[model samples]
Target: MNDSGRAERRETVAEHKRTIILDAARAVFEAEGLQGASMRMIAKAAGYTPGAIYAYFPSKEHIYAAALGESLERLKAATEAAVATGTPAQRFVAAGLAFFDFYDTNPRDLDLGFYLFRGGIHPQGLSVDLNAELNTKLLATLEPLRVAVLDDGAGADRARVVTADVLAHASGLLLLAHTKRLALFGGDARAMMRTHLCERLARGNTPESG
Candidate 1:
C-alpha cells in the first residue's frame, strides 16, 4: 500500500479501537457513574488492559464527555426529524415533545445526559472545554424548536425566551414524572406538555407591542 493508503488504514483502525473503548466506557459510566467509575472498570468491560484503554482515551472524564456527546447527537437527530414536516407552530410543538419523549422514554439516557446518577452539574475531572462543548451539543438539540418559534413570528429574543421556557418545562415535568411526584396531582406529563404548548402557541398568536 502507498504511504497515504497505509495512513488512512491506520487511522481507521485507531478509530475502531477508540469506539470499542468508548462503548465499554459508556457501560461502565451507566453502571457506576463518573465519580465511581474508573479506567480499570472500563478496560475490564472492553476486555482490554488499562494501558490499552489509555492509549485511546486519556482519562475517564474524556470518555464520559465523548459518550455524552454521542447521546446529545441522538437527541439532536430526534428533534430535527420532528420538525421536518409541519407548520411553524406545529413544528415547534413537535420538536419540544420529541425532546421530552427522548428523555422520558430513555430514562437511563436522561440520567446520563443530566449526570443524575453521576456528578450532576459539577462532574469531576471534566475540563472547562469539555464541559462547554457538551453544553453546546445539548443546546444544539433545542435549536430546531427555537427556529420554529422564530418562524412563528416571535422576535429573536422572544424566540430564545420561549425556547428556554419550553426546555425548562419539559425537564421539570420529566423529573416529576420519573420520580412519581406528578402522580400525586393526577397529572400526566405528556398531556401537561401538550396543554402547555397549546397555551404558548395561543399566546404567541396574540398581537404584542414592545
Candidate 2:
C-alpha cells in the first residue's frame, strides 16, 4: 500500500481498537468500580493484549472516564426521549423517573458515572465541549419548566433559578432512591417523590392571592 493508503488503514484500525478498548473498559468499570478495575482485565475483556489497551488509553482513569462519558450520553438520550410527550411538569417527572429507571436497570453504569466523581480524580476524558453538550441537553429538558415558571411575569433570572432547583431536587431524589435509603416510602417511593416535587414546583409558580 502507498503511504496515504497505509495511513488510512492505520487510522481505521486504530478507531476499531479504540472502540473495543472502550467497550471492555465499560464492562470492567461497571463490575469493578474505578479503583478496582485494571488494564490487564480490560485487555482480557476486549480480547486484546494489555499493550494494545495502553496504546489507546494511558491509564485506567482514562478508560474509566471514557466509559463514563458514553454512559452519560446514553442517560441524556434516555431523558430526552422520555420527556418528549407530556406537559412540562409531567415531562419533568418523567425525566426523573427515566433517570431512575436507567440506574435501576444499569446500576454498574450509574456507579461508573456518578460514584467516580466522588473519588476526586477530575475525570479528564470528557472534553469541555462534551460538557457543554450535556449542559445543553439538560437545559433543553428544563425548557418547558422555564416557560411554565415564567409565564406569570416572573423574571428570567428567577425562572433560571427555578429550573436549577427542579433539576437539583430530581437528582437528589434519584440518588437517595438508588442508595435504597428511600425505601421508607415502599415500592412507589419514586412516584411519590416525583409527584411531590411536581406539586411543589407548580405551587411555587402559582399566582398567590394578596
Candidate 3:
C-alpha cells in the first residue's frame, strides 16, 4: 500500500502489540509476583518470542512499570469519575468507595502496583513515580472538603492532618477487606468507619455551647 496507509497499519500493530505485552506482564506478575516473574514467562504468555517482547519492553521490569502505571492511571480516572457530581462530603465518600471498588475488581493489579513492588526495586531500571502523583491527586480530591471542614471552625492544618489520618485508615481498611481479614467485623465495616470518621471531624469542628 501507500505510504500513509502503511504508517497507519504500523501504528495499529504497535498499539496492539503493546497491549498484548501489558496483558502478559500483568498475568505473570499476578502469578509469580514481581520479583519472581521473568521476561521469558511474560513473552510466553503473550505468545511472542522472547526477542519480540524485547522489541516492545526491554525487560520484565519495564513491562511491570508500564502495567503498574496504567493500573494507577485507571484508578485515578475511576476516582475522578466517582466524585465528578457529588457534594464535598459525598465526593469524599465516593473517592473512598471508588478506591475500594478498584481494589476489589483489580486485586492483582493493585497487588503489583501498591503492595508487591514497593520502593527500591527497579525492574529493568524502570522506576515509577506513582506515590507522589497519587498523593497529590488524593490531596486535590479532598481540597474542597478540606476547606469546608476548616471553615466550619477546624484549623487548616488540623483538617489536613485529620484527612491524612482518615485516608490512611481507609487504605488499611481496604487492604484488610481485600485480604478477607475484615470478615470478622461483618459487612458493615465501611459504614462503621465512615460514620466514626465523620463524627470525629464534626466534633473537632464543633463550637463551644456557651
Candidate 4:
C-alpha cells in the first residue's frame, strides 16, 4: 500500500481496537459493578494487557465515560429517527417515546448512562466538573426535540423548560419502572409517557396527536 493507504489502514485499526476496548470495559463494568470491576478484568475481556487497556483509557472512570457516551449516542440516534418524519406534535411526542422505549428495552444502557440503582453506583476517579459535563452531552442529545417543541411556538425559555420537564418526567418514570416501583402507583409507564407529551402539546396549542 502507498503511504497514504497505509495511514488510513492504521487509523481504521486504531478505531477497531478502541471499540473493542470500549465494549469489553462496558461489559466488565456491568458484570463486576464499577466498584469491583478492575482494569485487569477489562484487559482480559478485551484480549489486551492491562497496560494496553490503559493506553486507550487512562482509568476505569474514563472507560465508564466512554460507555456512557455510547449510550447517549444510541439515544440520539433513536430519538432523531423518531423525529425524522412527523407532524410537529407527532415528532415531539415521538422523541419523548423514543427516550422511554430506549430505557425500557435497554436497561443496561440506561444503568450505564443514568444512576438507576440509587446509591449502588457511583463514579470513580473523576473530578466533579467532568461528571457534570456528561449531563451537558445528555441535554445536547435532546436539543432537536426542543427545537421541534419550539416550532409549536413555545417561547425560548418555555420551550427549553418543556423539553427539560419531559425528559425529567420520563427519567423519573423509567427509574420507577426499573426499580419495579411504578406498578405500586398503578402507572403504565409507556402510556403515561405518551399521555404526558400529548398533554404538553395540547397546552402549547399544538395538535395533541399526529
Q: Best candidate per lDDT, number? A: 1
Candidate 3, residues 124-164, lDDT tens digits: the string is 24454645554455566455456545655666667777567
Ranking by lDDT: 1, 4, 2, 3
Please name the candidate that would achieve the greatest TM-score relative to the true structure. Answer: 1
Instruction: List candidate 3 segments past 4 Å from native.
Output: 117-163, 200-210
Q: Any residue pairs clashing in model 3, and if so which?
A: none
Kindly indicate the candidate among 1 and 4 with the higher lDDT.
1
lDDT of each: 0.88, 0.68, 0.67, 0.83
Report the C-alpha displacement of residue 84, candidate 1, in angstroms. 0.9
lDDT of 1 by residue, 123-183 (tens): 5678999989998998899999999988888888888888888999999999899889999
Candidate 4 residues lying further than 4 Å off, grouped into runs, are: 117-125, 205-210
- lDDT (tens digit, per residue) of candidate 4 on 1-210: 899999999999989999999998878877777777888999999999999988888888788888887888888888888888878888899999998998899998888877433336466555677688787778877877798888877767777788888988898898899989998988899999999988888777433322
Residue pairs that clash (backbone atoms under 3 angstroms), model 2: none
Q: What lDDT does model 3 reach?
A: 0.67
Give the Cα error of residue 180 in candidate 2, in Å. Answer: 2.6
Against the hidden reference, what TM-scores do the models get? Answer: 0.88, 0.66, 0.74, 0.87
